[model samples]
Target: MAEVEAADFETAIAECGFGLFNVFILISSVPCLTAMVFSAATLSYVMPSAECDLKLSLLDRGMLNAATYAGMIFSAIPWGFIADTMGRRVVLICGGWLDGFFVLCAAFSQDFLQLMVFKFIDGLIICGPFAVVVSYLAEFHGKKHRAYVMLFVGLSVSVGAMILPLMAYCLLPVHIFFNVGQLQFHTWQIFIAITSLPSLLSGFLHMFLPESPKFLMSQGNYNKALISLQRIYALNNRKSRDSYPVKKLTDATPDRSDVINNPNPRRSRQERYKLAKKKFCDGLMQLRPMCSSPFLGLSIQVYCLHFCQIMCVNSVRLWLPQIFATMHTFRIRGMNDTSMCAVMDHNTHGRPIDTKSMEEECDIHQDPDMYIDNIVVAAVGLAGFILIFPFLRIAIVANHILKVFLFLSTFLVGGLYFSKTTLTTLILSSIYLTMMGVCATTIISMSVVIFPTLMRTMVLLLIMTFGRLGSVVGNVLLPIFMQISCIAPFLWLCTLMTIAFTISLFLKVDVQQSLN
Candidate 1:
């Protein structure tokens, strides 16, 4: 038998060429983005509303927030492992379907307990596609374009953040009734239900998309990898003149090559599985190595950076609606006094006035209906924010700058609340939208590029797991702050941002001009 040379991974990919489905990839990210916004917006504020509607204690509400991200933190790593072990396509599609189902479950929850259970499950299931899809996007692009495309993914998330609130704003205005009783549905419920549509679409689209060729190559399926590459080329509308070049695979010398003997290839599939398992075990056993000098220093650097970011964001997002609700109340009270004063002025000027009767007039402006109209505040803020992120970069230094901007806005919101001025509240809310959109994109985009390719998925899993844990704490921390004073949460956010800003200056390594 003649000896055959192995294929080259990189050259094979290069010759096969990049795909034109960058738009598809962008579209694919819509579900992940939309799901996060849907989950975050709903989970954050649902606590207060649950207290309002179902009359649950604040402790129970806090439990729900904790439960939701507990699910997220637990599910992220396992899903990443599955995506690596199985394939990205199947896991992504499942994520979409699960998202829609769980969201609907949340919408129909009869009580806080039911809502908590369903939401936790939804959090676990829906987030499978989140980091996995980002990993796929990274895998598809060449080194030169990786950051650029990931930026697009980041941008898509911002667009989702904008759109999610708008959808909630629209769905929240109407009332729904049932035979048992008139059940009033709020904007949050509607937001959760409608946001699931994007996930559904993503699930459908993933049916046609190819599996990751890189994954296939890792598994030692060169022919399968080639076929996957062909699909990618076709999707991109590039001519598949040559299959994913085999030469690069031979040159790169994938780990699987060692399993089959060139000089010592005799391992069976069982042995290879054992070897892979051993590597996984080794990674775990080397906990000390993971924290050793350079590794520990780098990990600490990224961890603190992400920790501060997530912690501040979690608290802010959870309390924003409550803050807005207070602002709306202030606005209504001001409008009422202003109207009353005008009426008194007119009566004093010889106009006919029934002062006793006027005092009996009911002001429905303070009612829940008032809340429906003001959903646009969140909607407008989100939309305006989505439009502003494309021109921004994921600079670490800028991350803190954005946080500072958010803090200043938070100060404005605090001031307005204290001073009881509606205009200041409105202005602060506008700035809040812009700051959130920018901060979100910057964090995700920057995180995606900073890690190396081999550890990319693992590192992302680590980032999200811990980052979201912080988010979970932040969400629950709302009630803790509320116990002291309403302003405490914002004050904490300000402090967290100040810390993050200091860290960003030293921690961020600019990867924009540098290629991996």
Candidate 2:
């Protein structure tokens, strides 16, 4: 009798049937994505109230803001390598727990140096799940639903951003202070702790989820991969595993054996050490394919786009709390006829000193309007993501959408620079930031489609590494640029967005021809 050939991965996955399990996967992803946003962004909200506690100067604030990105930039590749070599599930679970732990540690930090160290470590651990989760989620879905699922992940991110300001509104204004021995606990500290719960919860949720069947197949674990698909089928379709239509998965790499399932209980120390060394070297070797041939050009374009988009978006996004606070100060002083630069200038060099007052210099009271403004901005971004979700299904629409958003963002950035009223500045800035954010997610979705499964996580991490590097640079430079001249940072961002838009134009060919 002739042997039966197994179904291909995509075909097998599609047979798993998208229902309860698919929805569970998407629901489970919310906290993981939300944790990434909160870990990176919570510091922006914390800094305003924490300045007095940490005794932060402008340089200190910039460094603190950049610290998490610095950690992510350094660690992204290693996490990617681990995910590619091992499995995505372990990486996500372990990373989430460790990230949450570091965030909790940050909450207890008593000084600037301690908090800085913890925040950096938080970034290092969080990068694991942040870079891997999207790839992990995409592996489960068929090509038809993959792009939409990734965009939904992006929408979850915007939800996380919206949650941030609401949390800040409820927590940052509260007056809480106490001393536990040498440690001083404040409302900001409590806020940090609260923000960390999502990472922990995400880790907990992953414990119940199955490994990515696509990742299993990539490692030549055909039997285990088929079993995984069956499990997915059982959960998603509410049927017995025997009912799964795909009996087996086609062996993509027949030469490679299943490294994950066949574990030896007892091995000599020397043998174990040698095995570890070989796997590490093999992981390093995985980078070669991405750096050469067809992938190299696509990698470069997406990486540059990620860098520029993140640089512009984060440079403004991370400083929004401070900027809003500045506006509050301006309004307090009855300044009506002022641009953003004028308000900045007034806050910097024109404030009248009230030496007669005997009140504490550190005012942690955030006005209600600041939080409302932030919520409004986040809500606008969220709405944009929802509105654009349906159009993503159209052919070539993602590419066109990217170009339009980038061009609009560039124009909005320039307009933001010239706006003389608070409402005008807020509206332009909101649209600009939202558009850039949407473009960023669109780029990630495109990358997921363009790259092969073998090097997908590696490519994403490399792209994200560039993006975080841009963020670190932007966060550090924006402050210095503002001090030099307000327009310098805006002009710099405008130039970068223009360049990104141009680079995006070259990506059409690769995007149109993607295998996914």
Candidate 3:
């Protein structure tokens, strides 16, 4: 095995310049991650309508919310290995198209079983695109620009969360009813379709993308790595390919051939099976080193911190809209989104709410105002991420800063449900939401800065995977617990977040060294 140094690769990438190339990738990958957000959070758009027609129980709706993540909880780590084996491009292309197809199928599902199946497949397929984007973007830039790239992508995700309901606001109210045999076309269907387009479109667009240079280098394709870097340099600097800088990387760079992608052209089925078994065994052996001795402790620490962080942050992201909507019913002046959807729902049955009332007791009204509020709060959160990025040049400061914000946000939210007036609750909620973006950016930045290059991709994927697991558990229990008491869900959030905060107290990472 030959060496491929990070500094050498980093220098070649840095010569590519952080202009048009990084901007293009940063823009394209946004929709991929945001589509994952839609997949996990689509229940927000669907529940209000499902409450009208599907006649779903509160628990049933919660299951639907968790369905995609149910798939995610099990799929991500395996997908990480696949990404390492088959290459990022294949995963993104296949996963992107499959996710859209599954989501589209889910939109047409006539029963709970069908919807869950399709949504699970959607989650299964999406893990690739979402997880690969982290590594893909990192491979495109030098370390100096990597944090900015992640922050920008995070900002895009925040914007996506903000715009989802606004888009739902515009499209979900349309009374566009038509039929294709057993299928009915309506707002939720339309919203699902619109959200699915980005993934489908991006997937096809990705067909034209090159494999990650770092992945190529890992595969011992130094020529291909050089070509990829040269291409990026030309695009970013608006120069001819021949004129790009950084002709070659150092020959003495580290050899990471253990995880490199290699495919044989002609092999028997039995031979392939044996090869896979051997590779799997070998990969397990490789992982054992990281899980034992000195690296073992840090590995466990990072995963636990990640698990706890995801448990708290994802819970908040997944349920933000519903929590806001539930809070809306307490409003004396605003009409809930239920009333807004009345016009669309009544088109099917002359009286939709009347029919739904016979099935289950409905209490809180869905307010579209909360959509606007989410968008505004999300914008504020985006600002928080941007505000924190510069300070993140100091890695220790980043983690500590996040801890302080987490403490404050928890306090605001824990007191929110106990507020004396609706106004006080609203104020607390706004500040709580504002703090979310800051917390999110910090988590990602710390992970990127602190983890080693060899382990970075796997760690990020685990963070995302466990984050989905958190969402699955949180959404499932949120409505059930909220039914018990107004403060019950927040208390749950506070406990998980406090646990995350406490975990951070003991877990240690070489944040300053990784950055330097």
Candidate with best TM-score:
2
lDDT of 3 by residue, 1-516 (tens): 122243467777767778777777777787797887788777766566555556676677778878888898788878877776557888888888888888888878776777788888888888778878877877777777776676776777777776677786666545566889987665676777777987897697778778888777755667777788878878888888777656566534354443343556688999989988987775455345455666567656556655666666665555555545544543533534333123222222332246555333232233345465556556666676667667766666754766777677667757755565435544666677667666665566666656544455566677777667777877677766656655566678788778766766775554333221
For model 2, the stretches where C-alpha displacement exceeds 4 angstroms are: 1-5, 255-260, 263-266, 347-365, 509-516
Write down the lDDT of every candidate, Cα atoms only. 0.59, 0.82, 0.67
Question: Which candidate do you rate higher for lDDT, 2 or 3?
Answer: 2
What's the distance in Å from true for residue 395, model 1? Answer: 8.2
User: Candidate 1's error at 77, in angstroms?
Assistant: 2.7
In model 1, which range of ten residues has the least summed lDDT? 357-366
TM-scores for every predicted model: 0.76, 0.95, 0.85
Residue-level error in angstroms, candidate 2, position 351: 6.4
Listed per model in order, the count of residue pairs whose N, CA or C atoms clash below 3 Å is: 14, 0, 7
Looking at model 2, residue 16 earns an lDDT score of: 76
* Residue 463 lDDT, candidate 3, scale 0-100: 73
| Arranged by TM-score, best first | 2, 3, 1
lDDT tens digits, residue span 440-497, model 2: 8888888887887768888888888899999999988887887888788789989998
lDDT of 1 by residue, 385-468 (tens): 445444444444434554565455445434433433444444555566456556555565565566543345555667777777
How far off is model 1, as Cα RMSD?
8.0
RMSD of each: 8.0, 2.5, 5.6
Once superposed on the true structure, which residue ranges of model 3 sit more than 4 Å away at CA? 1-7, 242-245, 251-282, 326-370, 394-396, 420-422, 507-516
